[model samples]
Target: MDLRVAAAVSLLLALATTTGAVTFNATNTATGTIGGLRFDVAVGLDYANLVLSNASAFIWSSAFNQTRPADRKPVDAVTLVVAADVSGAAAFTAADVITLSAPYVGNYSGDVRTEVTGVLFHETTHVWQWDGQGHANGGLVEGVADFVRLKAGYAPAHWVKPGQGDRWDQGYDVTARFLDYCDSLKPGFVALLNAKMEDGYTDDFFAGILGKGVQQLWQDYKANYDA
Candidate 1:
């Protein structure tokens, strides 16, 4: 074997090992009807790792613009738990742990697998994204997470179309759509914005990035649709 070929193979293996180093775990705490739906922790863990790896890359490119592990959150493990008593189909994340309502899993009218995958992507974003030291708007935080979900191709059927939001920070799909517009105006807009949010958040972030206030940008976004 050529020395160059051997060195290339060694580099690839090291990269793969590093990428796969993050650990994922899943648990199901539901019983009865919900538990009967067969929560596969093994499969869920595999998918979570895949989504986490991919999301980190996409968000790094789209928001953080850094690929080094040191540039990311220091978390080395993430756990996905299924809970029976949570209200609504809503999911939440705390630190490195994500909890999905088992009720939502059992009651989902469509493909549960795809729905869960999307939920994992959104929740996993919460695990990795910086929060402006808890000073950023909650709407923007959720929107950024959903932005990852949107980029990952897991956007649900009911998401609002582009240029359809009432405000730039209305949050979730609305804010995600608006952020998407902002990114269109300048590539890596989200990445630069997220970097700014690391210390704290300001409305000026919009002006700093695009030379326009968020409100004016929102107006332009809505106007584009009106045209």
Candidate 2:
């Protein structure tokens, strides 16, 4: 074998050994009613794997600070299910599967394509983000997910503006805004905070990272906007 060819093969083998496998599937259970929406989400599905991969990379870059695949979640596959049965929620992710509401797809008044992409980006983050070993504040967990959405340029027009939330851990867009503020104070603040939460969660993580209590940070955040 040629020396260069042997080296190329060796590199390929090494990459195959180190890289993780990720799969994505999008299914529409509300086929009949979905009509054109089905086509839109199907298009979204076509890019689901790419979206998941990109979202994972973004999540790690934004919060986890884990550049290597080995440092992130060991999820092997993610499935997006669009169902009409889910009511009162646009979407929810459990484990590695994201279930989107088909009714939401059917009734969405605005840009369904972009909206679904945003929802997918948000839900996909849930599949990759740490949950403080299930001890973290639920609001913070949700906030991190929305923060991913925010960074992806998928933030909807209705989302609360920065420094507009009532509390730091208020969850969703509110907490996302607060987390963004925290991240602004120091680069990669979310990433370090997430790394600390890998084992478990503590309020001290805030003071340790930003030199201020979480409540104090919230107060400062609010004061910045005179809110």
Candidate models: Cα lDDT each: 0.74, 0.77
Summarize candidate 2's per-residue lDDT along 2-114 as a digit string, tens digits. 11222323443344336757666777666767633663544455655555556655565555677677787788888888777888988999999898888787778887767
- Candidate 2 stretches greater than 4 Å from native: 1-18, 35-44
Compose the digit string of candidate 1's lDDT tens values, residues 58-129: 554445675666677778787877787787655899999988887677667876677777777788888888
Clashes per candidate, residues 3 or more apart or on different chains: 1, 1
TM-score, per-candidate, Cα-based: 0.85, 0.87
Poorest lDDT segment (10 consecutive residues) of candidate 1? 1-10
